[model samples]
Target chain A: MALQLTRPVLRSQPRLLAAAQFLPTLMFATVAAALVELTLLRLLSRVAIHIPDVPALRGVYSAAVQAGTVTFPVAALLAAALVTVAAMAMLPRAPILAIPALALLGAQAALLVAGESALGTAAHQWLLAVALLAVLFYSTSRRMALFVAGVGVAQAAGLAQAASANLAAEGGRALPLSVAGAGESLLLVTLLAAPVLVGPRRWSRRDVIAGGVVALIGAGMLFGNASTARTLALWTFGLGMPLPALLYAITAGAMAATLIALLRTGAIERAGALTLIVLGGFVPPNSYQAGLLLAGVMLLVLEQPRGPATTD
Target chain B: MKWSKPAVLLVGALVIAGALAGLTGVRTATSQAVTLKAVAVADKPELNPDWATWVKIPSVDVQLTNQAVTYPKGGGTVPAVSLKAVHHENTLYIRASWKDQTENVPSIDMAAFTDAVALEFPGKSAVSVPSFCMGQPGSGVNIWQWKADAQAGAGSAALAKLYPNGYADSSGFPEELTKAALYQPAFGLGNPVARTDAAVQTLVAQAFGTLSAAAAQDATGAGMWRNGEWSVVFTRPFSAADGDQAEFAAGKNTNLAVAVWDGANGDRAGQKNVSQFVTLQLSGELVKAKSEDWGALWFGAILGGVLVVLGLAALGWAGVAGTAKERA
Candidate 1:
């Protein structure tokens, strides 16, 4: 009886340990896939959008557009699956936090399977807002927690505003500015500055230099010509940001600096997650996009336990 | 127990590979959408939705949402639309259908509204597609809008014939006033709203407030309502002489967007269901215009490719250099 009991215990420990080890890697994969789906796909679409009328480049544009559109949803779906698995793996370690996150994801997946009805869309939006809150709750670092909370609030407000905007339009009256659009822009600007505000305490000399170069380049783009700013504004506008072009230019520069800081400090997963969140902002309001944004939030905030089965 | 470095890396690679393989399968399924082949028929496809040729071709169900980006945003009146297209000779006929419980026709009554649908295409000379909304500055769009009232008025142009119950007795007005065409400013100025020549209006816009009638009027359309469903057909030639109009060619890929307005839902300009741009493949052999200079476009494409490649390469090099320095 003693031998059997010990044997079972031995078996469970390794399995738990394996899951613990697997969580970070799964999160990394999730981040990578989401980045490809959101960022890379959007970039390709931008290129295609700009060159659709060029006869010589028509073939290239057509092929790229088709490939990008087809693969983006697949990448998003894959990221969702990986995130779900990662959340499940975290259950044994931090069941209290992981359960709600996992439940939210599970509910989203089930709703998606049923097709996006009006009821389903509303439910998904609320669940997404809650999921961001879960991210805020899961953060181990105080500074990161604050940032996540702010982002969560902004995202929730933005979603609510978008829904209301739809209703308000029915009155045949127009608002001076779209609150949802402004909120989304604010969220993006905050996210772009995240690395500077909430990153590692000390940065390497090389990191500082690299970040400087990125900033200079961004500044040059912003001040160089009206076209760059115009393009950025148009791109953001297409994604639903009705803000000025100058604001978008400044944010683009900040985005570059943040990425350099994160990568240099060895936050590869965070860098990828950040990219996803930023790109997710630009995509049209949809359930799958919202879920992916939440996934980015989860990956950015969820801290993996250092040891096996540490019930934090 | 400590895991070996190589073993960990191997497991990680395998997991990523498995995920990629699954995604590839999904990609394959999605790629099938790119091959939305247009049916080629010898005879001119009839404008009727129930025509034998139209039913034989495949149909795509496109989801739509409200025009939230602009004011008057209450859309989702019609959740989805079914589209079928065919090319016969030099003309392309596109049929769009959606389900509705009531048919709202245009009327002289101030409270009455007309059901309308429009197809938007990017201008031929645009460096990029304009805003999916009406359009953006710099880049323009060509719009072909068909209204239920316009269709109803196409056959019977006289106001008396359209609204028999509504009496507009010109008997009270002086004969001189009735004879003076200038008295009717809208019709005299060639306003599309006042004209009854065609059911479809060919329009151009640089942005929201810039919508106006196009110089070229090559497209025509009609709508029929039966069994609580509206089927609208848009017919246009493969090309238009005016630069403001979108040109379609055989065996070329173009982008298309759709919008629908339900009169009963108080849907009108900017308050209608809309769709994102979808790739439209016209079936045939692409005959390049040899007279135009292709060198400039080729150079621009090459330059863009080079810039992108360099940017990516720099990022990769920086990453590698950083890792090497850390090891050192």
Candidate 2:
């Protein structure tokens, strides 16, 4: 592993470097902890938190309860933003992750918010497309990522909304419009991933690990449950467990290999921390996934590498 | 400790699953079966309802939609699946049959999906079975799942038989797509059908993974689709390594559940119909399962695909940080 020492960069400004080193990681940990805490609360309250819509007061209370759901994650994002400001004040390179990390955190908060609303739901898909692009190109190829973002904005803002409006005027046919929405989202990801995979970037370890973990989780969900595994195997694909497993595995493995290649080829700088920050907010396997992501980010930012040994 | 957090996470998943399973103890659904006078083979055409002795288990109609956030839009009701189970010559044979309009087996195209069936049994030897909903995550269930395309016999050259005009040019078909070995059923290396050449595959699982492929496939079955119906059969050894799995012994009573997915219905993952725990009478006078309220179906199909997506990201991260040196 290569170390980019911040202390030298901070020789004239130690306090700034110290803040840089701690800010992102601490913010990441705080966000991770908050997500984990929310998971715990949600699990514990799975059956307990039903707000009925009846009397005006009850409806108001229910609406408040629903609105309050976004409180924690948004707060975590705000705190991270504050910490980013603190870190950026001292270290110029700080806040490298804050941009993309906050974007994904905002996306997650959108889901936490009125995710069921039409526009909110629509935006969620676009955000996911952005997140996948983060997994693929974040530090490895910012140019490509930026380009994809540009394309996504143009497609979603101008084309998709217009298509929705045109279809809505024709009598609100849902299935076709929904399909269009899904296709747009799917196309965005395919576009984001394909070029990056074929580009000059080398393999990134973060991408590989994240891809592999997601595949593993899919496999677990598929094979872990007998009913699901069987339906997909027999009725759905006509292939057995192997086909589905291979599907997820190959998708993940390809991303992993591409990421690894990018890393080995030295295509970019330390996007690993940024990647982890993004993952910490989104990819949760029981809340600890966020923890693991934060822990990875912390190890890099907090624990500076030592100098080579000197002989006596 | 390095393993503490993940371990706790795993425990939390299990506990939550167990608690959920405990909540559904009151639900029960059954699939009836009669003994077979003769042995049954996976691809054997002679194995019909009379030979297998069919017991029609009414619709497992507990269904769910794409609400899980995986597939965008698709869902339909599951027609009842006819189930048959018998043990002959050290093999336990269980067959599932259901009605489907289209045989959506070859999935090289869009909106194409094959039919599938699954059986869940307590992974333990005890009479006390866990809930049918995947045994509360880690509580463990030895599931024998049979997918249609993966089945043998009737599926022989099935693509050629079904789609004479599926392609525009004869030579246009890719050669690599022709071999079964290249399939890599589930996630294991090599092929399970190397010796048997059977298509109906039986896979085992404990919980929602990122799960690994079973080391060995001890069971097999084949699917036969004709006139808008599919009958798939499963045959496994009468006895498996006991303790944390269902016993396949003769004359033993056990509890099991059945689930079916009509692929065209956009049914996949947790989005399908399922049955509650039903009694499987292996010997003597038959004991039919008490058909309680069918409402339990909805309780089981409620899904969470987000966790699955999260688990995938974690897998990729693990790949990068595979070793301490790598992290360094």
The number of the candidate with the highest lDDT is 1
lDDT, candidate 2, at A293: 38
Model 1 TM-score?
A: 0.50
Docking class of 2: incorrect
CA deviation > 4 Å runs, candidate 1: A1-17, A31-40, A52-56, A163-178, A204-244, A282-284, A304-312, B1-144, B147-198, B201-328
Instruction: Compose the digit string of candidate 2's lDDT tens values, residues B261-325.
Output: 67777566666666545445453223233234322421321122234234433443443345334
- Model 2 spans with C-alpha error above 4 angstroms: A1-312, B1-75, B125-128, B152-188, B191-196, B210-212, B241-244, B285-328
- For each candidate in the order shown, give its overall lDDT on alpha carbons: 0.59, 0.42
Supply DockQ values for each candidate: 0.03, 0.02
TM-score of chain B of each: 0.71, 0.55
Worst 10 residues of 1 chain A by lDDT: A1-10
**Tens digits of lDDT, candidate 1, A114-179:** 432222343445455555655554455555666676677777666544432222211111122355
